[model samples]
Target: MPRLIYDYTKSELERVSLSPDRFRRKLKKAVSNLLPYEMELLQKWLVFYTDNRPELRQCISELQSDHKGVC
Candidate 1:
């Protein structure tokens, strides 16, 4: 069965909250796993999630232009 977005989002958030490296890794994994609509929702959530995290914001900004994959 496919994973539920809520569970995936929650688990990944907890897993990557500590560092930018982990956050980037998990974001890539999420991008690969989720459908386009799911990814869009995830991106929105990511903006709120990363809003206060300068390291994560920097990491995201450094992603390739094609994969600017998050908000």
Candidate 2:
């Protein structure tokens, strides 16, 4: 089964060592501070958090493009 939003976000928070509030701040910072490649990964992670397969697939496709000389 696919992961739920709660589980995904919880794991991400632990991985980054950030409190919920700080994670939110960092996510916002990423919007401006991250490079195109980094942003694509972030976007894919965010979409995965939603547990929406179609959207996640779309994000993955875009992320793949970033690896193919698009970024």
Candidate 3:
């Protein structure tokens, strides 16, 4: 089964009122139920959005700075 393991920490989810354990369980179930074609469609949309948008590339740099605590 495919999984959607989030990279965020437990403290991060707590800050957002999302229980990490519960979210992970739900994500596991959802991912297991997703069809292969659904995953392909998601990949297509991701490519389409990122490939066609220059602003998103800039956002990626901003996100990197935020990750490094320099934002």
Checking candidate 3 for backbone clashes, the offending pairs are none
Q: Candidate 2: lDDT of 41?
A: 62
Worst 10 residues of 3 by lDDT: 5-14
Span of 10 residues, lowest total lDDT, candidate 1? 62-71
Candidate 1 lDDT (Cα, 0 to 1): 0.70
Q: Which pairs in model 2 have colliding backbones?
A: none
Q: What's the true lDDT of residue 7 in model 1? A: 62
**Could you tell me every candidate's TM-score relative to the true structure?**
0.75, 0.37, 0.31
Superposed Cα deviation of residue 8, candidate 2 (Å): 16
Better of 1 and 3 by lDDT: 1
> Any residue pairs clashing in model 1, and if so which?
none
Worst 10 residues of 2 by lDDT: 1-10
Model 2 error, position 55 (Å): 18
